[model samples]
Target: MLGMPVTSFGWSVNLIVYLIEEFNIKSIAAAQITNIVNGCLSMLPVVAAILANSFFGNTPVISVSALISLLGIVLLTLISFFDNLRPRPCETGSILCNSPSKLQFGILCAALALVTTGSAGTRVTLASAGANQYEKRKDQGSFFNWYVLTVNIGAIISATAIVYTQDNVSWKLGFGLCAAANLISAIVFISGKRFYKHEKPMGSPFTSLLCVLVASMVKRKAVISSKEEDYHNRGIGKEAKPSVSMPSKSFRFLNRAALKTEGDKKPDVDSIKNIWSLCSVQEVEDCKSVLQLLPLSLAIIFVTTPIVTQSSFMVLQALVTDRGLGPHFKVPAASVQVISIISSCIFIIMNNWIVYPLYHKLTHKPLTPLQKVGIGHVFIVVSMAVSAVVEAKRLRTVENEDHMSVLWLFLPLVVVGIGEAFQSPANTDFFYGEFPESLRNTATSLISLVFGISFYLSTALIDLIQRTTKWLPDDINHGRVDNVYWVLVIVGVLNFGYFLACSWLYRYRNLQGDNEQDPKDIIT
Candidate 1:
């Protein structure tokens, strides 16, 4: 529901402009309010994620959020239907010209925020929860691949369907359809709960890992070398003092004293073995290994953020492009996302069917997650460079009073989608492989946090540039968006360099193999 409205809003920017012209209202003021609504809504995912991790868990959170989103969609539909009854000038015949009272608009904003909060929670929790189910099964690798595939399926469907609805009907219908879809998803989820594995909130895994590492450090420090002398000692060996031996007594008396009582049997061999293992120095090193890697994993999140912006920002760019296919047919601007979706599907097929198998056959090495991530970065950089060229062409086109072909935009989008298909799946695999079982959910959340923060940062940068730059024109088509594209180019290049650094750093580090014993299992 939230995504559909957001997509529609991007398409309807021109519609908002038309509303201003028709209603003779302060356009900038309305635009500001809308921007605030969008930004605040975007933050819903973070809040939802926290709630899923801390309190409600996935099922209840997703269910409740879907219902709330449905209500919000209903409200929007009502607002649309009642447009003619509201007081407003109608010069351009825009839907928003049916100027509902400021109070009505405020209510709409409130409802949208409510929808956002619910959608955000659902988005954050659902995928992880699905993945968690796979962990209970032994052959989880294939399950996870399917999980990622399913997400893409939903995204592809939503992008196409919502855009089609908005173009063919109205924004209200598009949003209402999304709300209905979410409600159905909620019902299906509830029905399937018994078939799935449920997860309990384990208090922050990062904290737990840190605690174990600190304890290990303390234990290591407390160990005193038997060979080292104390400050008071000058030449004496610490544990080599000579002692006189005189004992010659029989042990029969001690054997009588050591006879077992009713409660005492042979000592449990397994328990003694466990205690011995826990006290070993190797165990301490294992804990330290986990501690050392977590921060590094956190660092990877920042690098992963830009990959996602392909979908978010690309959708925004498509809105301003002219998309007439022929004399009587015009593609909806938002429908350009279908290119990315199709490209992603193709990429997945090529990788799974050809690329990975060919690589394994030629090199006799299974594809490593880091290697996959590195490859993903290469694609992302290429995509960004392609985008920069397109933007530059667009700039030139504007200067010469010529329109650039929409196909130019499609090329970069396709490249970026392929990059995402590689990066997202590899990133998910990396998290699962790198983190211990106890910390899987938390690790997943950290991944989500990286994505969330990246989007927040990207938007902030976009808004900052738009507000600060005198080069940008007040009109949409006439603006210096090329500069923004160039900035994205720089960011993408930096991301590629960062990934290379990470790959080099990771190569020297010892990673645990899939069959390696967990520290907790080894100790206990």
Candidate 2:
């Protein structure tokens, strides 16, 4: 966990600087490219998880991905080593710059592709793999909290040490360290092979979902039936009676998918024969579970979009702001996120060790995942508001020909970290607990999935803002970045309300059975 993020962030956290200085790319263009890379890093985990849960098991997929990461980072190291691999340096403050050749650009793209793939794959699979080692819910929950801590710790090292080295030392040395970290992570994962409790591939639950949709549409006119014997149990063996969950009454139209007509007369014993026409009762319920999560998921997209957008923009804000720390050390612009990481780390530790335990004892009720997530929402709104206020102050300072300390960026970023502390692990626990066991790896990757969509949307939002308003430009000194933050403040506030509606309407699923309707609305 530690080595992977260290290596991943070691290169990526400083990517904007690398592109602008080394590749001679424009600043705004560089930020977009970085967003695209981060988007890929967020997106690919779903694919990896689907593969892990459907085809190959976790270990095999992860083992191969780690090697891919090592290979990719090594390739990046080589690019840094060879002058021919990059373009000539652009003159400082000059509009015109040397554009990278096709060869240089291609190698860089290939390297990033590999690194993003490796990083995303390793993160999701390793998370699922770690949690799988523990059978008890408490143990799994603890594993998740610690998993987040380790990832943040790794990021802290990359954001601080690696970023500082890249800024003051050399890119070659910084990238070399990243490659070495990847190698060490691979070695450690391989060495721990015998201890893991491996789960076999469950085949694609998504396929079953598809089958449910198609079968229901095909039989949309069929009369709904409540008979337990009428619904197919294809998930069970032909002889064994699978008496678990009958077709659910909610989304009663979908119940047609499991209801048997002439297609059930002599159902082939070999397989779910022509599963498009008939599905198991379990499959119907699984489809409903995913549907039930839609509103909550959509609400979080707003939550995630603002946070990610703010994060990307903060780097740009750092570039324009005075970054001095002590007399000797000026913090790297890319390292600005370290504040957020540290804040998150602190909150996660306190939440796990002190806050949660203390709250449970005092209130006689443990904190539910929904409550934790709500707390995160409150913090995110505050963070965005603070961000806009700080940016406005910085702009005024810059306009007056006075300097604003980089420390001013600290408040919003710190709130961001605290929000992450609550929302991230809480979301992990919620999805992992609620999603069907067959989709365990996929459940773990849903947070990554949210990030993926959020980053892509944020990229679009940035593009839209750049095109329509004089908010983000090649030189932020001339742009109204505070306006951009103001827009996000609106987004965060609106989304917080959306999330509240979703939480109030949502009822916690009874995971124990597919049929039982024990609805527990968001825990007060």
lDDT of 1 by residue, 1-524 (tens): 23433422332322333234323444334344434444444446556655666665767776787677667656655655665423466656554445657786576566666665655556546666777766432244445555566656666665566656756676667666666676666677678778877777644434434433443333342333322121011112463223212111221121111122233234342343222212223222223445545554544554544544444445445555566778986666556767776687778778877998898789665566667766776777777777767877876876788777677789888887787678767676666556555445444555555665565565566557767885344444566555666676677676666556555554212233442322221100
Q: Estimate, for each residue in 162-263, the C-alpha lDDT of model 2 and write its tens digit.
A: 999988998889999999999998998888888889988988879889989999999998988778888787646664434355876678888998888985
Cα miss at 460, model 1 (Å)? 2.4
**Candidate of highest lDDT:** 2
In Å, residue 348's CA in model 2 sits off its true spot by 0.6
Candidate 1 lands at a TM-score of: 0.72
Q: What is the TM-score (0 to 1) of candidate 2?
A: 0.95
Model 2 alpha-carbon drift over 4 Å, by segment: 236-243, 267-269, 272-274, 510-519
In candidate 2, which residue pairs clash? none
lDDT score, candidate 2: 0.86
lDDT of 1 at 324: 72
